[model samples]
Target: MAKSAPIDDVPTHGEGIRLGQFLQLAGLVDSGGEAKEVIREGDVLVNGEVDQRRGRQLQVGDIVEFGGRKARVSD
Candidate 1:
């Protein structure tokens, strides 16, 4: 039973947002290029599963994890 990192709530200010943009919005990565590279390298997780699509549409309540950090989408 290891303690998981606290999930941070990030506001999208819309109905939904792309995974790449959200990653940067939550301060997970510095730039879109970095986000794409990491995402393609299988370093990003969506709700506990690896997702490679940077354009993946994430709605409210979607959980994204990367580099031991987690962020939940919010409107």
Candidate 2:
């Protein structure tokens, strides 16, 4: 099962957060480079869609999946 949290959107911040930062913070991929590779290879998903941008910004409620693990952003 994937871990998810309820997040509220804030006007001050962008709808999505940085991909590399999110992976690092979640302890998913070890390094930013690794995350980039995974993303480039279509190994990651954002909101149920394959996303290949390492710098892609994930929204507050967006779901991120990689390596059979998933997480949702929350406040």
Top candidate on TM-score is 1
The per-model lDDT (C-alpha) reads 0.96, 0.73
Each model's TM-score, in the order given?
0.96, 0.74
Cα lDDT tens digits for candidate 1, 29-55: 999999999999999999999999999
After superposition, the stretches of candidate 1 with alpha carbons farther than 4 Å from their true spots are none
Q: Pick the candidate with the highest lDDT.
A: 1
lDDT, candidate 2, 1-75, per-residue tens: 966543323231444568877876776789988888888899888888998888887777777788777777755
In candidate 2, the residue pairs with backbone N, CA or C atoms under 3 Å apart (3 or more residues apart, or in different chains) clash, namely 15-59, 16-58, 16-59, 17-58
Q: Roughly what TM-score does model 1 have, to 2 decimal places? A: 0.96
